[model samples]
Every structure is written in structure tokens, then in C-alpha cells.
Target chain A: MKFVGVTSCPTGIAHTYMAAESLEQAAKDAGHEMIVETQGSAGSDPIPQSVIDAADAVVFAHDLPVKDAARFAGKPTIDVGVKRAISDGPGLIAQAAAAAADFKANPAKAAAAAAAAPTGGLATKVDSSASLGTQVRQWLMTGVSYMIPFVAAGGILIALGFMLATFALGKDGPVLITAYDINLPKDVAHSIMDSFNPLSLTWWAALLFRVGVAAFGFLVPALSGFIAYAIADRPGLVPGFVGGAIASTTGAGFLGGLVTGILAGLVARWISRWKVAKGVRGIMPVVVTPLLSTLIVGGLFIVVLGRPIKALMDALTNGLNGLGGGSLVILGLILGAMMGFDLGGPVNKVAYTFATTGLATVGLATDAVQYKIMAAVMAAGMVAPLALALATQLRPKLFTEPEQENGKAAWLLGASFISEGAIPFAASDPARIIPASLVGSSITGALCMAFGATSPAPHGGIWVSLLFGNIFGFLIALIVGVVVMAAIVIALKSRDHSLAAANA
Target chain B: MSLISESQVILDLDYPDRHQATRALAETLVADGRCTDLDLFLSDVRKREEQMATGLPGGIGIPHARSGGITTPSLVFGRSRNGIDWGAEDGPATLIFLIAAPDGGGDAHLAILAKLARKLMRKDFRQSLSDAATAAEVVEIVEREVVNA
Candidate 1:
């Protein structure tokens, strides 16, 4: 017997190919001939006309809308979920063949009803409950990808700024001062310094510099929204950007941006369900929704969110500045603990947000705060993924080949302050891995703070931060944190057979 | 071996679900005396599908089954005017390739699959096949491609 089949899913990632492989294997085993076509990201690549003409039966496994069902005007098709297609495709194909014969024998009733129904429209609604965890993981991945470049660009620039200022004060050769003058300004010459200062210099240049920084700042949210949009489709971007901007301007920082990005993506999806014309549909995305949403959200930030948050950020920065002797150690411990507690979850985000806010409002604005908490938070976050990767590499038996591949990427990502690098591990074994990550990250954070490491950059991982100042202490803190986390992971993973078994 | 048996092939003008596709394919087989019991063939294929999915990364689906209902391996191709959800990465599938190999064929079946996988990877070859309107043309293209490879 000869049969033809089609398999597809909404996102078109994993299940599509698995079903095709299964059905082909089954057909070969059962002493039959079969050909399968996958409708996925790459697009259709099969003999459509010939397949329709020669096939005795057809099977369709899909979740999203498919095209061209009308060509098989008289052919029987078995429509099932993509998951079902992968899990039970051959059976569906066989069922389709039998139903086709029965219809041919008694053509009138079945043909009439089937003809009346629209093609590719019959699909079971997706169960959101089953997909929530996957959605969260995807959201985190998008956020991490977006955050990396921001940390790199902002961190390196700020470091350069600091080094240049230090050189101008005669701490180093005038090489950095010359570079800063070319890239930005020179502060050594009183004439040059006076010419550029906000009060003494032309206000235009200062305004341009501030605007440039503000525009550069906008990139963090914009890119975050764009990545989330790509993952979740058109609707996800609007809210992602709005949320990111709100997070940024309100001192909620990157953590807030991550939350907003996810919120925006999910909200856009819900809104897309409101049926509208295809012509107007394009407008719903490119124009109306984004414009209105950004305004409403931005307004909310200014009117309600920003003012109250301003006081808290001020008080925190002030309190940190006031700490002395043993109290500084306690502060470091608290900040470090908060940084690692969530590892990019809500608590991690709060600490990160506070740090960025402190950079802008306290560090750059005034010398009111001597210690930088944001740097510690970022440093800690970076340590968790690197530590996890190292742990996985050390114990090859603890992870699958795929996970090991992810570990390499995680190490690179973590070194660059890409907090999302730990996602795959967290996803695979949340119970054991997350706690271990938190411990490692917290230790790094606290140690870095206690050792008096200060990062002028609002964001960065170890490498860029190390270039600024206090390289020795930063390296020590990072290595210690990584070792602490690795030990914890090794201990926890060894105790749990399920983790090893699952990965293996 | 011929890519497809001419007598066992049927051009379908109706679009039913998987049940209908199966029935149409089986009826064609039964008419050619390939199998005595269509229900047994249907059940076997359905049961086989319970293990894994047949959806490919590209926008294609290959649904097939193994059963005593067939005397020899056969290939069936179908096209949907309005495509159906076939669990493909891009979404729905418009073209279908069904393969039914004799039980315990082993290496022979694997050889055919290897050839098919290689041929399908070629964009122009797959495009030409999708454009082919007749079963003989599809068989001709497949045979030519396979022989050339």
C-alpha cells in the first residue's frame, strides 16, 4: 500500500521531523511504501501534484493553519495534532486509508459534509498549561541574548571613561587621555576642561553627549523587544519594548526590562486573537498597537512608577554609602545574596535594576556612594553560568552531549554577563541546578563587593570589568565563586540519580 | 525496481482527514490484490504511529505503515489544495509521501530511505517533483534521480 502524509507544528522546531522519521520507519517495517513531507521553517519540498495523484491515502499532523487542502478534493486525510502526528503518525495514516475506502463505497453522505467544511481549519486548541514552562524558558533566552551586547558596549565605554579620567589625574600615562579626547573629551588642560564642562563650556556639546547616551540607553530595550518579537512572533515585540523602556527609565534596570519583554510578548499574543481584517491586521502590529501601548505604558511609568521608586533607589544608595568597617561586609553579603537568589528571576532582576539605577543616579551623578552594588550583582550573575558550565564539563557523565554543547556556550555567555546562559541547565534540572547557581552567584557577588571592586559601567561581565581596575581581586572573586558553585553542583548531582539519568 | 507501481496508484480529488487518506490508499491497494484485510493494514499503521512523529524540519510529512496488507513496497503521493497541518516546522504540509515496505526487508528498505533522504535534500529535484502533475512523471523523476545518484 502506498500512503502520503504531512506534518507541521506552530513554531516548527522539534516535533515535525520526529514524526516523519517514525512513520517512515514504521512503513518500512510493515512491508509498505511511504513518503513523508515536512511543512516547517525551511518550507515545503515535495512533489505535491504527483503525491496527490498517486497516493492511496494521506495524513496531516499540524497545529497552525496550513494551506492547499483543496487540491485533494476527493482524497481522505487524517488530521491530528503535531504531537499526535509524531507519537502516532502511522496509525493515523492507516486510518485515513480505511476512511477513504469507506467514503468511496458510500460517497454521498461523507463527501457532502466534508465538502462543506473548510480545509486546514480543523485543529485542536493548544493547551496553555502544558506550554507555560516552555514559554518562560523562551522568554528568558530572548532576554539573555538581548542583554549581552548591552553589557559589552556600555561596560567597555564606561571603563574607558574611568581609565581616561584616572590618566588625566596623572595616575597613568597620557595615552588614555589622548584616546578619550579623540573618542570623547580631554580633561587635563584647564582650557579644554573648561570648554567642555556643562557650566563653563558650550551647552550644545554637553546636550549632544547626554542625548547620545540616552539614545544608546534606548538600544538595550529596543533590542530586547526585537529578540522577544522574533521568538514569540509579531505581537510579542510591542509590549516587550514598552516593558523594557519602563524598566530602564524607572530604575528597575535590566531585570525589569526582562520582565517587561516577556509581559509584552504574552500580551501581544492575547491581543492578536481579536479577529480583524487581514489588511488592517498589518496595521495592528506596525502602527496602532505599539504606538498606543508605548504611550500608555510610558505614561504609567512617569505618573505612578518612577516617583515612588526614586525614593527607594536614593535611600538604598545613601544607606550603602553610609556603611563602614564590618557593616560593609554585611552589605556585601546582602547584595550578593539578592543577586544570586533568583539568577535572572525576579529577585535577580530587582538587584540588577537597583544597580543600574545607582550607576546613573548616584555613581555618575555624585560621589555620594563609595561602593558599587550593581557591579557586584552583575559579577555574581556572570559567575553562576560559568560555574555551572565548569561543573558540567568536569563531570561529563552528569550531562547529555547536547547539554555539554550548551555548557560551552554558557561559559562564553556567562563571562560576558549573559545571565540567560544558565537557562538550559535550569530548565533540565530546576530543583537541583537553580539552588546551586544561586549559591555560586551569591558568593561571587558578596566577595567582589567586600573586596572593594567598583565597576563604572552600568553592566558587564568579568572580562570588561577586569580591564577597568582592581583586576587581581576581580579574578580571585570570580574563580572562588565558580569553584563554590561547581562543588555544590557536583555534590547535589551525585546525590540525585534522576538528574544523572535524565541527562545521560 | 520501479519507483512506484502504476496499477496501485490513484489520483484523489477528495480531501478527507487521515482516516480518509488511509482508506483511499488501502482501497487502491486492495483493488490490486495487495492485501486481503484493509482493517488489519489500517490498525497496523495506526499502531506504528503511536511511537514517534513523522513531521520533518522542512515543510513536508511522510506518513507510512508496515503490514502484511502489502505484497511489496509501494509509494503514494498526495497534494492538498488547502494544506493540512502536518506537524512541519514551517507549519502545514501541502505535499505528502507515503511509503509502505514489506515486513523484514531490512537493508533493502534502509537503502531506499537513504536514497530518498539524499534526493529530497536537493532543492531543484524536490521542486521538480512537487511540480510534476502525473504519477508516471513523479516515478520517472524519482527513478531518474535515484539512478543518477
Candidate 2:
């Protein structure tokens, strides 16, 4: 018998490959041949078409919904939890072989419905009774993941615009578009009001800056709208977006966006649950739900939530601006610790979201303090993975072959500022690894803040180091952090080695 | 000449805890000429233990290492009369498999680990090891289940 399989898990790290290995071994044990595809966080290895075409059956061992699942239709299938595949692979293979024979015998009814290419949104919803906090975290993560590309694109472009503008037109250069004057120094001045004109350097810089700012304008709305969509799905989008726009207009910022998004979702969900007539239910999602939810959320924001939220935003901005030497460094230390503590988990997301919101707060305003926070967060996040990679390289005998392999990947991931690359190491040895990351990151955060390292871009790690004000100081902080983390992890691990010697 | 021999197996062993059991296993490897330095070999094993708890379900503990101290790929099996804590949340581990492999060996070390891992998943393999009355009997079961697995 021949079988093809796909295995995936939500985290997509250890379990995916473990299941694949288990299944392949089990198939071989059952006197069959198998080819398995692992869909993991590191990505996947594509299976060949010939192998899939010749397979007697397909097995999907996954926790999350499989991507491109429609391709496996019409085949005799056995879909089970990843744990089942790992624990009882031979049993699953036996069942699949039997199911394949059944499919061959009865091809008409089973093949007809199963063979049709399913339209994209066919996901089997996992109906676990998740806690409130878990559900909210999932929704928030969904919004953050969606908003990252926008943040990266807008932030980098804006930084590039400023750099180009400064180079092309010095401090004494003429303004392309004044508050009221239409006629500009460049020939492309007329295009400002008319949409776009890329004739002159000054005009191009202005165009890039303006376009970047326009994309950034979607940041808050996208965050809030998606948060609501995650909770209540499509019907919550309109109200959530409108509420977010209002929050931005009212100077309420990210906090207000979060509140409005959740409010919109809850309101939409409540409305959907109402026992309406069949005809009314048809239009409820399109008409009644959107209309009522938008009106209520919008009105509440304007009449009630707007003033207090604005006041809170003002206080937060003032508090951040007022922080000086010690307080500022302390803030940096806390943010750094949070980022390093969880890698890319909820705690890390909080610090990142805080830094991004801080950037948004100073919309087009060049604030050194705001940039310092962003710089600290990025540097701290970058240190953990890089330090671990260095440790693995330094002491090859101390780590497993698999760990040494992970270290090579961590080098690029750390440089790209992806702290999550350190997740596999941390998961294996949380006791030592996490504390090492936390201490190193805290030091980086403190140093970056103390030295007043300012970054225009919120992310892009070492790649965008040139865009920062105190680039030398940033590099020093990062280097010092890596040294501290690598030394600490090596020391801790070696101490365990010494303890074992003593026991022996 | 299999990975596990009668001299490597300890039946009805009296060990207070994980530390003692680990030490005893390391000493056995050194005494059997499977390992060069007990200190270095035990150090690597303990480091691996600290990294991961090494406790498996069904009252099993597998503390494994690939180190420069190892002279040959070896399996040290110890069946405790009273179970010792190997960091399993449920209870202590009665059956312990200490796998020692050379640091610079070919894929032979990984192959041993893979075979051991697959056999450890089977209830009957674990039960057979537990039901064995003597050290030689324990070695025989491991030689059949894991050495040729």
C-alpha cells in the first residue's frame, strides 16, 4: 500500500515533524510506503505530484485547519488530531488502508461529494470551550498579525521619505506645499492637489511622505476592525472601522481602538443572537446588525467614550514625555523584559503594541523620546535569539545536533528581529533560557534608553539601524546584550554539567 | 555485540532519587568500558536532564547524551525496586534507560535514539522490561525490542 500524509499543529514547531516521523515509521512497519509533508512554523517541504497521484489514501493530522485542503478531496481520507498520529500512527494507517478499499468499492456517492473542489472558506471550526482571556488573546493576536505588514510598509517608507527629502533638499530648501500657497518651487507642485506627480526630487519626497502617512492612517482602523472581525466575523467590520476612525479623530489612539473594536464585536454578536424571523434574519447581518451596531458604537464614542478616552490619551502622552533619566531607563527595562520573556507570546505582543502605539501618538512629530522606546523594544527583542545562536556555536558539544541546526536559522531570524526564532530553545529549557534572555534584553533596553537611541522605523531590526539617531550607541547596546546573554546561558548550562560531575 | 549487554542492566536497584540513579548509571558505563570519563559523560547527561525533564508516560525515564566522554554507544537499564523521581508530574519512574553515545559519531547515535523512542511508545515493551526478574532477562528483552528494533 502507498499513502501520503500532511501534519500540522498551531505552533507548527515540534509536533508537526514528530507526527510526520511517527507516521512514516508506522507506515513502513505496516509493510507500506509513505510520503509525508510537514506544515510547520519553519515552513513546509512540498510533496511531489506523482507521489500524491499514486497514493492509496491521504491522512491529515492537524490541530489548525489545513491550507489547500481542497486538493486532497475525492481520496479516502482520515483526519485526526496530531496527538493521535504521534501516539497511534500504526492504528491510523490501518484504518486509512481499510477506508481506501471501501472508497474503491463504493465510488459513486462517496466520490461525488468528496471529489468536488471546495470553495476556499471551508474550515472545520474547533469547538473547544476556550476561556474569555484565551478568546480575547486570540482575537488580539489576529489583529496584530494582520496589522504588522501595514506597520512595516508605512514605517519604512516614511523613514526613507525623510532620508531622501533631507538629502535632496537641505534645511534651507523651499517648502513644496505651504498651508495655503498653490505655486511651489518644483514643477510637480500642482499635482499635490490633483493626486500624484513624480517630476522633481522635492515633489517625490513629499509624495512618498504623504502616501506613507496615508497608509499609516489605516493603522488604527485596521487594528480595531480586524479585532472585531476576529470575534464576530464579517458583520462586525463596518462598525469597528468607523469606531476606530472616530477614535483617531478624537485623539483617543490605540487604546480607544481596542475598546471600540471589542464593543463593536460584542454588539454585533448580541444582535446576531436575537431570535428574529427568517426573512429578518436574512437581512440582519447586512442591514440591521451593521446599521444598529455602527450607530450605537459611533454615538457612544462621540457622546460618552470620546472625552474620557481623549483625556486618558493626553495623560499617557504627557507621562511618557515627562520621563527623564532613571524613569526612562526603567521603562525601557520593563518593555525589554516583557519582549524577551515570551518571545512572540502575549507579553511580547503587549510591549510591541505599546511601542507601535507610541509611534502613532507622535504622528509626523519628531520626538526623540518616542523613538527611544521603539529602539529599546527592537534591540531587546533581537538579543535573545542572537545570543542563543552564539552560545550554540561556542559550545557545540553542549547542544544536540538538532539544536545546532536550529542555531543556524536563528542567526538570520535574530538579525531580522524575530525573537520567536528562540522559541524552540526556550521551550526545551525554559528555566535557564528565559532568564538569560530576560537579563540580556533588560540591559539592552536600559542602555538604549539611557543613551537616547532614537529609531524612526518601529521594526526591521539591524537592517534599519542606519535610520536611528544614535546608531553607534544602538550597536554597542546590542553587542553588550549578546555578550551578556551568551555568557550567562553558557555559565548556567556548564554549571549543570559540573553538578552532574559532582553527582557522579 | 549489541548496544545493551547483561553487564549494563541493574535489576531491583536501590536508589533514593534521580541524582543517585543517574550517578549509578554513569558509573556502570565507565566500569563496563563503554565510556572514557565518568565525570564528562555524567555532566552531559545531567545537562540534557536539566534541559528536559526526561520523564515519559507509563513510568519510564530516558536520560540520554552524546558526549566526548563516551567511547562507545551504550544503553544502561536500571529497574528500581522503589521508583525514583525523574520529574514526572504523575509519579516516579521505575524503568530508566540511560543512553550514552559518542560526540563525533556518525548517524549511529541518532539511529539508536530513534529505535529506543519507537519501542518506548509500546506498552508491551515497557511491561516486558518491568516484568523481567533478572538483569540478564532485562538485557534480553531490550536486545530483542530496542537493539534490533
Candidate 3:
């Protein structure tokens, strides 16, 4: 068994090191693996999150309060004074091993304890009595349920715009009309608006698509805002919305939105608990709380966290770029998995960018590797929504009425190359949906690459059939991916899993 | 300069109480030009001792502090052959190590003292310290074992 521990004393010098050394020595004598983080006068060397996450049990021998004590909340823990660790290191190790075994033996009770463990910031709600995982699910559900209307309104309008564009123009209809919907200069757009033909379907298509684009902008911020609202009531909304907007501007997407929502909520909840004077108390909630919480959460997200996330994204893009020279099949698989991993989140955008950039390099060579990558990317992107739709079609009982409705609409979205159609489902139940989608999408990507399918067009799924080089291979990959992904999703959600417990 | 020298170590460090022994050991720090003000540093050590007695089982007492008057980190060693009651539950301590570090320069020397603290847990290290005849030998054992810098 593996163990992780922290040791600290009042002075944080001699006894702290002694206790840590004793525990390590005792664990070695007992032939067990143990890692101890010494919080001594010489400052603590913090345990990385990965190490803490992997540990079987945690032992905190501290006279001082453990720093970030909440990180170890879900693990089995042994709490004792510092001297006890120094005196009876073997006894503590034995107890920790037994506790780990006992926890593994009774996971339901352990999970219940974890749920009741009292999260760091969230102390007051009736939902605190529920397990930790459930509390998170509730928060996410709140955000998703609130954001679904936007998803539907925005997605349908965009699809309708594409349909109308197809009706108004020829084969190059969507490609041409999308120009009006994107990157249009402010002056050029104003000039076009000055000569607007309100009755023209072409103009209507551009307007609808543009409005849908604007509506889509709100999806991330709304999700973030409502999540914060769920956590800290109304006070959380400002920071959450601001953070989500920043996340969007920074291209951090839905993942960043999720992080900002939780952070803002936690900060808002924390600020609400401050003890202020009677005069200041009146302004505390309305003025002071919002102002302080927004400043803190916004500052943290942009200054501290934003850099690491941006760096990580850049690293991932560079890694993918390096992998271009490696096996094309593997690249396809990797990109496919990323697309289904987060839907329209950062990872999906990276994969999409990789393929599109390859298209830009393709220039006139239809037989270039870029075309094959583009074909594989499109095929892989279609996997999530199609699979989710298929799952709802196969087992409507597993999903809610709203989800079933989303599923029915997802068919057209999935067919028209809208990967974000699955965002509602992914947001609602990521644990099941993401894994299932990743597996199926990667397999589809590999299959498409293997078949040497090519797409000259950057966008579009089945709608722009004329541009596809090897349509048969693309269809086969899409069909296989859809079936595999749907089957996995159905298999996953059909069970009494923790994620969909509320929905069920 | 070394953290400890011959002038800093007193093999027969017997005294009626720990205060006299600590004062005697501190005088060595003052003589070595490591302490600027003796009274202030002793008061700080006394305050630390009042908080918790610096006693250990198996006959060892380590009194340590970060003092404003401490110009550089220094170690003052003493061995009480007859044993001095440093408040250990088991018995009086025969070996005592006084560790003084400069304020805010803790990382440089506390790391060395921390090693000394852990090494004192070993019977061989303690035996090596007790068996050494001269102050130079005691310094040799400590320098080699825990405080190399």
C-alpha cells in the first residue's frame, strides 16, 4: 500500500524532521512505500496534486494547521499530534494501512464520508449532507440546465442559416455566406447593412447565422455564471460571468468557464462569511462582496492560472505539430480523441486548428497529408453528437425530456459538422460521455486516416459531399464511430452510475 | 570559518542547571565573534526553552533559536560526563548541542541542524560523539556526520 503524510511541529525544525524521518524509517522497516512532506521552519515542500491523488491514505501529524488541508479531504486520513509520529511511527503506519484496507472494503461508506467531509469553502448548504461528488454534479447540472436554452436557440439558428444558405446559393452557399457571418470588417458590414435587403433569403441567412454566433458567445459565460449562482447564490454571478467572458476572450472555452465558475463561487461564498461592522454590513452583500469577490477571482484567473493554461495549450499544440512527422494514423487517433474529449473546448479547438492549418498549407495539392488529416478530423468531430443522439434514440429512458429533445436535434447538428452539439450532454455527464466519445472518436480517426479519405473543404460533414475525395471511406468511418460511441454511452448510462443518478 | 571549533566545545560541561551551561556555551559564541549581544540572544533561547524544554530521550539536549544578535549561524557543543538534567523524561542529558542561526538566514543552517537532529536519532552517531576524547574529535564526528558545511 502507498501512503502520503505531512509532519509539522510548533517550532517546525527538529521535531518536524524527526517525525518525518521516523515515519519514513518505520515504513521502510515495515516494507511499505511512504512519502512525507515536512512542514518545517525551512518552509514546506508542497506535495504535488498527482502524488496526493494517488496515495492510498494520508497522515497529518501537525501542531500547526495543515496548509491547503482541503486537498486531502476525500482520502482516508490519520490525524494526530506531531510527537506521536516521532514516538510511534510504526504504529501510525500500521493504522494507516488498516484504514486504507477498511476504506477499500467499504467504499459506499467511504464515499459517504468523503461527501460529508465538509469541503473547504462550501460549509453551509443543505446539499453538504450529500456526498462530495453529488454536490459537484448538482452544481454542474445547475449550470447546464440554465445554459441549455442558449444551446438550443443558438445551434438551431446556425443550422437554419446553413439550410437557408444552401437554398439561396449553389454548392458553395455555406462557404460563401459564412464569410458574412465571420471576420467581416466593421465598415464593410455597416456598408452592407446600409444596402440591406430584408426580404432576401441570402441576407436573412447571414443575419441568422450572425445572431446565432452572438448567442453562442453567451453559452460559456452563462454556464459559468449559473454555476457560481448555484454555489454562492446571487453574489457569485458577477465574478463568474466576468471570468467566463475572460475565458472566452482568452480561448480557454468551456473548461475555463467551469473552473472560473467553481472558483468564483468559492470566493463569493468565502467573502460572504466575513465579519464586518454594522455600517459596512449593509453594503457587505450588495457592494463589498461583489466588488471584492470579482476582483479576487478575476485576478486569480487572469494573472496566476491563465498563464499555466495558456502554456499548457501552447505545449499541446506544439506537441501535435511535432507529431505531424510521426505516424499519420496515430496523429488522427490523437486528434480524434481530443475532439470528443471536450467538444468545443480548448482541446477540440486545437485538433480543429491542426487540421485547418494543414488545409491552409495544402494550397492546391488535394493529395497532401493535410487533406487526409482534414477528412479524418471532420469524421472524428461528428462522432460525439451522433453517438449521443443514437444513445438517446436507443434508450430514451436513460435521458431527461430536455436531453432527449437535445438528442433529436443533435442529429442535424452532428451531420452538419457541429461538434459542439454534444456540449449539453458532455456538460451534463462528462464522466460517462467524454470517455465513451473519446474511444469511439479516436478509432474513427484512425479508420479514416487508414482509408486515406480526403476533404478539400475545411468545414462541413456530409452536407458538402461534392468536395469529399473518398466519400465511401469517410461514411464507413463515421458510421462505425457513431455506432461504437453510442453503444459505449448506452452501456455506461444504462447502469446505476453515480454521474446520472439524479437524472435516472 | 567552520560552524563549530575547539573553543566552542567543552567536554566537561557539568553545571547545576541548564541556564549556566547555556550561558557558558553562549560565551564561546560571543568569543568567536558570532554573537553581537549575549544577553539578548540568551533571553531568546530562554524564551524558547520556556515554551518547550529542548530535551530528548537517550541522553541528548538540543536548544536552538534564531536570534537578531546572531551575525552568522554557529553551533556550540558540550558534553556533561556526569549528566545534566535538561528535562528529559528518561534521565539527564550527557550530550548537548546549542544551535544558533542568523535571523531570516534559516534555510542555510537550519537544514544542517535538521540533519543533526535526525542523525542524533541514531545510536552510532551518539556513541561516536560520546566516545570522542578531544573537542576536535567531537567536531570531526559532527562535521562528518551532519554539519559538513
Candidate 4:
């Protein structure tokens, strides 16, 4: 007997192919000819019509609705769920074959039975637990995609803004500045200062400028939440956004916003799977989910999470405002160590959040500790990918061709404070890479602290230099950290002659 | 009709390398009238393996040459019970089906390979094949599982 099958799933990743494999194997074992077409993210690749026409039976195994159902019109078709397709596809195929044989023997009875059978389609039967890595990757991918434009726009605009400011200041004749001064006439200086004054601009222009800045400030969290929503579906957006906003306002920082974004997205997704009413399905996704999620999440943040976060930020600010000599260096070391420990994982995010909040609260008040910590964290995070890339290049034999390819991309990403660029390395050998990155980052952080590095901007890499502060020390710290990491990797790899021999 | 003697050199190979494994198997089949040229058949099989890793999900690898590589349609069962590094993701491969067929023999070879893939996925069938020591025993199992289709 000949059998034809269609396999599909919603995500179109693992289950679809697994089911196809199971069914094909079953058919072969039963001494039956079979062909299976897979419908997935790559789209459908159906078995030829001729094959289907010659087949004794057809099986449709899918979670999503199968396309071109009409083609199987007179054929004995069994519609099963994706879970069944993966778990019991072979059994179903055997059953279909037996049924087909029975039908062939008693055509009139089989036709009558087929007419009486329900055609509402089968329900999915797989366990619904989302894995941790899958969840993390989903949220991270969304955040990364959304964060791209904001990072690009903000970095470019700020760079250009600094250039303009410098040019304007230069034209006005240099003042006798205390550090890194350029000579200029008094009248020119006055004109330069006046041009920079907010009041000098037209009211509308000033208002627009302020609005743009405000929007720029909020863009990161907003986009982060939206991206999380996209990953988790409609219900995730509201809570994600509200939680992000609260995180930002309460000084929980970008890390907190990220956490809230993921939490909200997951909650939204969970609610959607509650098997609610069909009549209210549309409303549940668009209206009820978002509204209820936002209220609950926003209220929680404001009442429970927000107050403690704000108090912590206030304490940190007060300490920086009243700090002595060695405190700045110590803070820098801690921040740098944290940033390097996990690259872009939770530890790194916590360090980043700390720096951003520190800068926001204390940088405006002539506090140097906040600047020191920010500089160190940013420097440490930037070093990880660059270090890994350099290590791969130095010891190419120790790594796979794919790893080498990823190394090239990592170089650019590392230089830009994109810690995620090191993910491929971590994924391939988390045990070795994570520890190595942490050590390198900590070294960089320590150097930054020792040198009293300062960066007004909370972000890192070359872009951090644009903010009003000393950049030379930050650059030195980053370079030193990356170099240290490279040396360690090379030394470790050199000792593994067996690995080299295998590659050869 | 059997094109080659069931006792031909197709089954008894214990080579270290992939090229050697193919050549040894091909030479056996050729000596038994399964094919005309061992070198040509081995080369064709090697070329196909180069195009993609033949490693299946389970510990099986089906390395087959196109019909042009053979003088006649034949199934060669080669077992490396000691385990050979077949570049499989799941490590070494224990079972191999070296299929050779006459030029333009339609999709019979593909159908056979597909059948073998399905049969190997079954725990009982795989275990039975693993336990089968003699070439005749293996042939009987394949004919029972696949030929009935």
C-alpha cells in the first residue's frame, strides 16, 4: 500500500521535521510505500500530484491549518495534530492503511462512514512548556532588533552634536580652559555661549528640541517593550511597556526594563493560551489582554518594585556625592567585573543598569565615581568579543570554520559595545568562553578604576567618548582588557596540541 | 533475479578510511558481478558523500552511488559493528547501505534508501539488524521489511 502525508507546526522548527521523519520510518517498517511533504517557515514542499493520486491514503499532520486541503477531496485522508504526528504518526499511518484496505473491501459502507465522520480538524496534543533558552533568545532577538535603530540614531546624532559644539566653540576663539584648553577672544566666546543658550532659539524650536530629546530618552524602553510584545504576541506589549517605563523612572535602569519586558511578554503569552471564548478571542488579544496586563504590571512596579529601586538609586547618588579618593576605583572595578562576568547575560545587564543609573543621578552633580563606574563597565563589556576574535585569529586551528567566521563579525560588534556579538562563542563552548570573558572584563574594569577613567555617557566603545569627559583612560582600559583576554586564550589553546592535530 | 552472487565480497569489509570502505565494498560487489568497475563505482559514491554528510539522525549512514555508477541494481549491506567515524553528528556509524543501480533505473534506488531510513528508525528493527551476524540473515530481514512494499 502507498501512503502520502503532510506535516506542519506553528513555529515550524523542530516538531514538523521530527513528525515527518517518524511517519516515513513507520511506513518503511510496515512495508508500505510513503511520501511526506513538510510545510514550515521555509514553506510547503508537497509531494507531486501524481504520487498523491497513486497513493492508497493521505495523512495531514499539522498544528496550523494545512493549505490546499481541496486537493485531497476524494482520497481517504486522516487529519491529525502535530503532536500526534510526531509521537504516533507511524501508528496512524498503519491504521490509515488498514482502514484503506477495509474500505476497498466494502466500498459502500466506507463511503457512508466517511460521510458521517466529523471534519472539524484535530487538536494539538504536545506539552506546552517553553524552554528557558528559547524564551531568552526570543526576548533578546526582539530587543536587539528594536535597539538597533535607537543605538544608531542616538550614536550618530550625539557624535554630530559634539562635532558641531566643538566647531562652534572653536570659531568663538578659545577660552583659557582649565583642562585641554584652546585660546579664543572674549567676544567670540560670548557669541558661542549665546548660540548654545536654549532661550536664544525660537519658542517652537526650543519646544521641538526638548520633545525630541525626551523621545530619544524614552525610545529605548518603548522599543524594547514593543519587540518583546512582538515575540510573545499581542498580550505582552502593554505590561512590557508599563513595566519598562516604571523601571526607567524608578532608576532600576535598562536591565530592569529588559526584565520587565520579558516578564510582561511571557505573561501575555500565557494568558492567550487559557482557552478563552471564541466570541471574545479577538477582543482578548487586542483589548482585554493589553489593558489588564498593563494595569496589573504597572501597579506592581509602582507599588512593590519601584520604591525600593528609587531608594537604592538615591543612596548610590548620595554616596557618590560624598565620596573620597579610593571609592571611584573600587566602584569601577566592581562594575567592570560584573559587565564581563556574563557578557550580555543577566550579570552584564545588571552592571550596565548600575552605570546608567549612576550617571543619570550623579554625573550632573560633579560626582566622579558615577563616571568612573560607567567607564569601567562599558570598557569591560567591549573587550569580550574583541578578545575572543583576536584569540580565534591567533589560534585558528583550535576553532571550527564557523567559529572563525563568527569571529570576524564579533570584532566589529565588540568595538561598538554590542556584548551579544560574543553569543556564538558562548553557545559553542559556554564553559570555557564565559569564564574567559569574565576574567578579561574584570581585568579591564580594574584598569579603568586604577586610572580614574571617566565617561559622561552611560554607553560604551567609541561612542562613549562623545559625552563630556576624559576618553583616553577609557580607551587604554579597553585595550588592556582585550589584550589580556587574547593572551589567555592563546596560551590555553597552545597547550592543546591534540586539538591542533585534529584540525590538521 | 540476483545480479551478483550473495557470497560476493560486498559484505566483509573492516577498513579504517571512508575511501577504503567504499573501494573495498565496490571491489567485492564487482568480483561477484554486482557491477563492472570498482574504481568508477567508488568514485561516484565518494562524490555523492562529498555533496552532503549522509549521517542520519540515528546511528545509520546510507551512502549510495547514482545508477550510472553500477552495471546493475543491487543492495550491499555493510556493517561496522566496531563503529566507524562516518562524520555523523551522533558520532560513529554502525549500519551502512551501499546501494548501486544501473543507469536510468528510475527511482527504485531512492525508494530503497527511503525504505531503509524508515525501517532503521524502528528500535526493534535496528536491534535485530545489529544482532544479525550473517549477510544472509541481514538480506532476509531487508527483503522481509522492504521487498514486500
Candidate 1's displacement at residue A291, Å, is 5.7
Q: How many residue pairs clash in each candidate?
A: 122, 0, 2, 4
Candidate 4 TM-score for chain A: 0.59
- Point out where model 1 deviates above 4 Å: A1-148, A170-216, A219-306, A309-350, A362-371, A388-414, A419-432, A458-460, A465-469, A492-504, B1-149
Candidate 2 regions exceeding 4 Å error are A1-24, A27-59, A62-128, A171-199, A362-367, A501-504, B1-149
Q: Tell me the lDDT of candidate 1.
A: 0.60
What digit string (tens of lDDT, one per residue) describes model 4 on residues A257-340? 766776677777777777887898879877888877777777877778777666765676677667666766666667777877
DockQ of each: 0.02, 0.03, 0.28, 0.05
**i-RMSD values for every candidate model:** 10.7, 7.0, 1.9, 8.9
Best by DockQ: 3
lDDT of 1 by residue, A435-459 (tens): 7877777777777766767675656
- What global local distance difference test value does model 3 have? 0.78
Task: Please identify which of the two predictions, 1 or 3, would achieve the higher DockQ against the true structure.
Answer: 3
Worst 10 residues of 2 chain A by lDDT: A172-181
Give the B-chain TM-score of model 4: 0.81
In what order do the candidates fall by DockQ, top score first?
3, 4, 2, 1
Highest TM-score: which candidate?
Answer: 2
List where candidate 3 sits over 4 angstroms from the true fold: A111-504, B81-83
Give all TM-scores, in the order shown.
0.48, 0.64, 0.45, 0.51
- The C-alpha lDDT values of all candidates are 0.60, 0.78, 0.78, 0.64
Every candidate's TM-score, chain A alone: 0.56, 0.78, 0.46, 0.59
- Model 3 per-residue lDDT tens digits across residues B36-147: 9999889988887887787777788888777887987788889998888887788998999888877767575677766766776677888988899898898898778777
